[model samples]
Target: MNFSSKLLQNAVEEFGRLPGVGKKTALRLVLHLLKQQDAEVARFTSSLNLLKEKIQYCKECYNISDEEVCEICLSVKRDKSTICVVEDTRDVMAIENTNQYQGVYHVLGGLISPMDGIGPSDLKIEGLIQRLRQGAVKEVILALSATMEGDTTIFYLYRKLKEFDVQVSTIARGIAFGGELEYVDEITLGRSILTRVPYERNVG
Candidate 1:
């Protein structure tokens, strides 16, 4: 087979580096991009660059933001007395899409997975503790996934925050086992939030 054009191969390799994108799909995307006009390709490339250049993690919650603090953390309408704990910014977006939560959030970056070598200290847990110590937060909702790693992360947080005196709860298991928040419907997410149960450190 005559592999023509190093530029096309380079584009395919770059796209393939993205999560879940296979070599075939990457090649397809590269071919599609090649068919686009130079101006359109420029626009697409610029937008991708802008995403990295414009967004930075909010210092308080670790959520992606274009400024020092995310819009959610700065909004006066949001309840500062409640914080939803999530594994990543995608989960924050998922919950926000429901438009049912009024509180701010704390992104843990990732969950606890001993097999994956991710520990409690590897997450943004210290920031959560700092926020709690600052007071005024009445509740902390654990909105992690229903996986074993998610369960482990929640348990670790439950123990860590037990001394804070603020109510700590977990979003209900209304979401199917092993379901990721990003894949759940808005109504189901809202219901799970509404039916969240208090965290009893003693129970499983």
Candidate 2:
């Protein structure tokens, strides 16, 4: 796309770097921002800068937060004994929208995708194992997506946690194969969480 100004072209290029954003969409966004008041644009840029500088991953669960520990981990109302394991912060938000789980979470950061060069050692699996060893957790819910990578991660986690006294379970197959938690409807996701089965039964 041709631009009258280098500054506008630079902004569009930067916006295009975002996932799912094309050059046309990025140009549109840049134009929209150009129409906004100077103060409004400043606020928008300032918020993004602050987010980059201030965002912190929760030391306990690896979830994104503003402090050392996430608000969910610190909540007294959450079930400390049940840890719902998910892929990332987006999945955490998806499950929270269902209002079906009271348990705390353990964000795996990402799945074990060999094709993508991600492995158990690259994830936060060791932290999860350490939490299990602490003995406060009684159940570990594999709330990962129904993708192959998700299954691989769950299986790896099961093998690691088998010696721990904690019960390992997986969300019901209400979600179709290859389905991502973030894209599923709230009711179906909530039911899946409610109808989770033992890891042994799920695999058997």
Candidate 3:
């Protein structure tokens, strides 16, 4: 193949590697980029590069940040006594879009999945425990998914945090089983936050 053809194929392969993009969609994206002006493609590539180069995890909450701390963590207007724990950055974005939560967040990076070899140690649980030990937070809200892994992670965190004096809670059942927070509507997420339940141990 010629240089231009090879470039197109490379772009398609890169796009294909994305989570849900197939060969056809990858090809479409490559063709779309090809039609754009050189400067436009440059701008797109630069933005993509900056996503990795500029963004960093907030030291306080583990959320994505352009600086040392995320905006939510830095905001004095937010309720510092509450911390919402989520499985990923997308979950953080989902809850933020709801505009209902006034507290800060702690992104666990992932859920506990034994089949996938992801355990509590692999998440940010240690950070959360340390944060609780600081005694500033009065509540830790588990905003994890309603799936099996989500439940497992929640239980694990609950067991560990039970020793702490802080109150522990989980989002309500407004979200359906097997549903992901990223796909849930903002209104549903807001309602779930409004109707959160305390994390009960040994419920029959």
**Weakest lDDT window of 10 consecutive positions for candidate 3:** 195-204
State in Å the error of residue 157, model 3: 0.4
C-alpha TM-scores of all predictions? 0.82, 0.84, 0.81
Give lDDT tens digits, candidate 2, residues 1-204: 778899999999999999999999999999999999999999999999999999999999999999999999999999999999999999999999999999999998999999999999999999999999899999999999888999899899999999999999998677776899899999779978998878897678
Model 1 weakest 10-residue run by lDDT: 195-204
**lDDT for each residue of candidate 1 in 1-204, tens digit (9 for 90 to 100):** 134988778878889999999999998898898899999999999998999788799999999888999999999999999999999999998999999999999999999999999999999999999999998899999999878999899999999999998999997556776899999999778978897767683245
**Sort order, TM-score high to low:** 2, 1, 3
Off by over 4 Å in 2: 175-204
lDDT of 1: 0.91
Decide which is better by lDDT, 2 or 3.
Answer: 2
lDDT of each: 0.91, 0.94, 0.90
Write model 3 residue lDDT over 7-54, tens digit each, in one string: 788878889999999988989898998899999999999998999788
Which of the two, 1 or 3, has more lDDT?
Answer: 1
How many clashing pairs does model 3 include? 0
